[model samples]
Target: MGWKAAEKLIRHWKVLRGDNVKKHIKQGPGHEGGIFTVEAPFHASNFQVLDPVTGKPCKIGVKYLEDGTKVRVSRGIGASGSIIPRPEILKMRTTPRPTVAGPKDTPMNLVLEKTYEPKSGKGMPELINILNDVANGLGSSTNL
Candidate 1:
């Protein structure tokens, strides 16, 4: 949208002579030093969210459901009136995580084992201290 909008603006302003021009002249090594068309930063209002359903540019509109949860939908300019799903980029994980416990994970039996000692008069503080000691390499797995 940025480069396309800038190109459209420049074409529309062709009548004016070198006035209010926003262009890039490439320089330095590996650069042609010729005028290069680039994207021009524009106002947020001019930005359009692509309608996934219609595969066209659209204005985003919020719709409230009966549960009072708001959902984004396609509105105006080739709108398909369908709920807009979140962007794929946002949903993608840079690194995939394991769903199941791995070899490095603590055994379930050990994790479920109780370390509480009510007779010692130690409560959550004792558990915290044990965890801190383990993290600092002062405690063994047996202490857990």
Candidate 2:
């Protein structure tokens, strides 16, 4: 086999070995700033999430229990809807988190309407525009 293939094989083997040993991974300060702990090889095969009704692969959604504890539920539609029982197979699974987006979708030009500008001025229009841009968060000092 090529050297690259051999190296890839070695990396895969190491992950498997670590998972086999149940290396603990905790939070705080790694390259990702997570805690230092034992590493475990995680592969989908080891902890499968399947739709109960169709026996097909599915995504899990999280909902809180009546007692306020969190649990995973099947996101599958129709009659396939069901709560996922704690997997008797895998010992651990990370909780799913919602992703968030910022102000990137907001249009900067819309922050100040043209009709609102000073009709005739030497520097008044320019000065007020900059102040309005900063106040409305449409622009910043760094852009200057």
Question: Would you estimate the TM-scores of all the predictions?
Answer: 0.36, 0.28
Cα-based lDDT for every prediction? 0.76, 0.62
lDDT of 2 by residue, 21-85 (tens): 54334555653434334556554434447777777767777889899987777774442657777
Alpha-carbon error at 86 in model 1, in Å? 3.4
Off by over 4 Å in 2: 1-48, 76-79, 89-144
Candidate 1 per-residue lDDT, tens place, 11-111, comes to 53323225433577858888678664554545455567888877899988989879997788889979998888777796799899988999899989988
> Candidate 1 at residue 67, lDDT?
95
Top of the candidates by lDDT: 1
Residue 40's C-alpha lDDT in candidate 1?
Answer: 54
